[model samples]
Target: MELKINRPTKGVELCLDLEKRSQWETLEARRTELAKDPTIDQRLSGGPVTEVAREITQLEKEMAAATVTFTLTALSHREWSRFKTEHPPRKGDKGDEALGFNEETIFDAVIPVSIVSVAGPDGEPVEWAPEKWAPLADEMTTGQYGDFKRAAFGLNLGEAAARLPKSLGASLVMARSDES
Candidate 1:
């Protein structure tokens, strides 16, 4: 029987390319030099120092992009809707009514998905087709899901992903993937 197993994994690394690293290093040096300048007055230090700091930050981000690898997953329609509702900055211009998630909420959701790793059954890995893991992820109990969510919150998204089933009653699902 052809089968596939989806799992979550923890931890990721950010890599930087040589050119980006050089730019980041130059910015870092500029920032350090600005920080040590004794002649700069607090009032006048804002513009120059702030500009250098911002450029440094931008370079750092560019470096991370050059080196870090992030995974992307396609969310099901229902999942997408749920995510949007749960983490929101709804597209409306109502000053009094603000129903939306800030950076923290977005990170909470993104970190979890970014760490998910799907593997096929002892074969070439395939894209985790929709409706496969969704049913199982849905079958998980509320508390079990909470535990999983907590892991994601802690930024320990995918490590020891196998333990998910033990937390959720495995018997609930007849089988993870069905090949008819």
Candidate 2:
């Protein structure tokens, strides 16, 4: 007898697990309620609420610094070149790469040049565009940009197979689902 194994045609997806994310909100609400309760202190309740509250704080911090994964469909070499040339790297005060521009700029440029998509909490893929990212990118602090830069670099480098590690890399993967 011959047995057949079914394989799921895997595809790249990027998005927060909605149910998991909702836990953060739920924790916040519980913390608020605990704070409002009277006689809910270590002295009376053996610090159960206090311990839970502390856990919530730690979880919130983790959420803030969480490394979100993004799947980017790279652009073609021709489009990549145009994007880099259009957004030339700015020189620093000492004629070096500008502060917060080198990696940050590259990551930001990747958005417009690539087809970036994210998944919903339900694991549904949602396509994102440069316009959707503009406001968030514009408001990011240098530290936040650093986080984004690292993630973007990893996504592009690994997915593009470093063919064009620099700004002008490959973009032919968009025609099909290819996850590196």
Candidate 3:
């Protein structure tokens, strides 16, 4: 069930019943609905044509101003302090907090790695298949792994056991399994 990598160490995979993120889908649907509605139509106005035209033109300007503008409120003091710890408050501390995620720079490094048969540096074709480690994916949205995020990745694993919820952490499987 693993999707082999293009080329690195053969990456592991798990068979997940992936589904669309509701947040992104809802945004798309709303955008489509808004585009279908015309807030001000110049052609629909009729009253001493020139006066109606002027009014319609003004309405068009206001309608244009109504375009979506995302306003991100400043993080609260507690949140700001946490963000500072994660992504520093000033330029000098950036390296210490954010590391490679510099303020002005994006995308740092990447090298293609084939998980299947590929020619090595010596020109010999090496056979490799990406290892597939199928840990059970949370099937229901209401499950413990409902969000399925990096933060929730290893709640069932050892180490950082104190960070997990009591009810959930107590259920982690600690048995050794060589099959995976």
Candidate 4:
């Protein structure tokens, strides 16, 4: 008999299209305002309302076409353990003492290690370095940064957690099904 084990070597890709996202948000707001106006006759405002909808659909297509994908790889168990040890929980009189990990500190430490590559909107490869993580994060909007952080964490930790069954019964069911 032969046995082989495969570790997780795959990277997760996350995409953010800021320009198109902002444009879509603006168009959505305009559409919402137009929707709320009780006095505006649909017949009279139809052209403007339709225009906004059309813009939204076009923007969706453009956003898909111009996606810049970021690839994040998981840290090995040993590397993850070392990172946790290096950034041990702080004990102090401050409220942060109760929280095992400081969110910002964790993000700072994890994001750089997890990011593997980035592709530009035009599908060209973009140069990236772990050292540039801070400056890149600073240039992003709050929402964009949050999203990037989430993707990094998800690739590192959340993927394993997400694979767990909801309960023991679910696990049993899955095992039994697999046996068949």
Candidate of highest lDDT: 4
* Model 4 agreement with the true structure over 1-180: per-residue lDDT tens digits: 899533333333334566678889999999899877886666764567788998999998787676666777667768776776666676763533553455547778887877778787776788988998888777777876787777756655675744633788988999999999
TM-score, per-candidate, Cα-based: 0.32, 0.42, 0.19, 0.64
lDDT of each: 0.51, 0.53, 0.32, 0.71
User: Candidate 2, residues 61-162: lDDT per residue as tens digits?
Assistant: 555444344455545556656655665657653322542234435667666445455554444665666687767667655555565555544544445454
Q: Would you list the rank order by TM-score, best first?
A: 4, 2, 1, 3
**Ranked candidates (lDDT, high to low):** 4, 2, 1, 3
Query: Which segments of candidate 4 are over 4 A away from where they belong?
Result: 1-23, 36-46, 58-67, 93-100, 159-180
Residue clash pairs of candidate 2: 14-119, 18-121, 75-171
Q: By summed lDDT, which 10 consecutive residues of candidate 2 come out lowest?
A: 7-16
Cα RMSD to the true fold for all candidates: 19.7, 13.3, 20.7, 5.8
Worst 10-residue lDDT window, candidate 4 = 5-14
Instruction: Look at candidate 1 and tell me the lDDT of residue 52.
Output: 84
Off by over 4 Å in 2: 1-54, 57-69, 91-106, 154-160, 163-180
